[model samples]
Target: MAQAPSTRLAENAETRKTRLRLWLNILRTARTVENALREEMRVSYDQTLPRFEILAMLERSESGLRMSALSEQLLVSNGNVTGIVERLVQDGLVERLPVPGDKRATLVRLTHKGEAVFAEMADVHERWVNDLLRAVPPETAQPLIDALTTVRRQIQQD
Candidate 1:
């Protein structure tokens, strides 16, 4: 039997079409960028994108990341982050130290190996971003970043 074509009610068609198009565009852009990042990470550092991101987060932290902080930053569960951290520690890329003020909390900091890997990772990450956005006029970059930040803040609001 032949499948019927997509049907839309006269009144709802345009609005639904606009929404569908927007979502499709978002998905496409996200998938493309994510794939590029993952490929870059795999080839350049022998790491996955999530692992690279986790390392970058720690690199930017002045005091280092707590397990809870890492969880939040990666949007993953504590169990997940714990395993990742353990692997990193075993690789001599990260150090788990006792948190001074909080006896119960442990701090996760990059070790010398971690710093070296992350510094190279950071360089590659920046280059990837720049290359991807090179077609976008430089003047639009700041406003684009601001817009995305605003969206993130709004989504994260209590």
Candidate 2:
């Protein structure tokens, strides 16, 4: 026998509610993990997550990134990037070079000191993340990553 329309509608509504709860849980868990990592970075390196992230981005580039590009990549305001980059410059960990042929633009890159510092922190950061996610079985890692990737793509479409 076929199910009634009302019953099917109720089941669909319940599935949507379940999906929403899962989404909220994902957001909450991410926030918690990020807060923990932020605290860890603050206490261990006396550095902010943004600074570490900036360094990581620069480290990936052989040359450097434009100031505006950095801001865009970080999804932050230009002022925010400027302040952090200024501090990093004072620390001698990063440098800003005038972009050739563009007096209005500058490129930011990690210095030798920055590179060495990031290498050390990156190693520990990986270990920290692994520790935090240790409950996840190794077998499930790829599937979990794939699922998140798919979710991100779908969200981006919206």
Candidate 3:
């Protein structure tokens, strides 16, 4: 016996609903984790996630990066980046230097103080992440990582 077209359509619709629910759940979980991390950073380091992000990126780049590049890497707008960089400069944690041969551009880099502060924050951040995921079995770690990686690649391709 062959299935009717209406039955097939119903099944497809059900599958789509289930997929949408799963995607929503994934986003909720991610947001919860981020919130927890943000709280920890605020209480312990007196810093916001975006500020920490900028320092982290600058720390990784020896020669620093252009303001536009930092904005791109952080997936934020240039205006937002400018505000953060200005605050960081005022705090003496970062410096903005005019790009050689580019009068209209500036490179942002972490100062020595920024590096030391980031090092401390990085260590605590790692610990917080490990604690957050400690409930999961060690055996499931690699599979979960691989699945998320695949999901990221597929979505980016789209």
* Best candidate, TM-score: 2
lDDT of 2 by residue, 131-154 (tens): 888988999999989999999899
- TM for every model, in the order presented, reads 0.80, 0.94, 0.89
By descending lDDT, how would the candidates be arranged? Answer: 2, 3, 1
Residue-level lDDT for 36 in candidate 1: 89
lDDT of 3: 0.93
> Candidate 3: where are CA atoms >4 Å away?
1-11
Residue range with the least summed lDDT across 10 consecutive positions in model 2? 1-10
Tell me the whole-model lDDT of each prediction, alpha carbons only. Answer: 0.85, 0.95, 0.93
- Clash pairs for candidate 2: none
C-alpha displacement of 17 in model 3, angstroms? 2.4
The C-alpha stretches of model 1 lying farther than 4 A from their native spots are: 1-20, 101-103
Tens-digit lDDT track of model 1 for 60-139: 98679899999987889999999888989998988999988899888999998999988987887999988976888989
Top lDDT model: 2
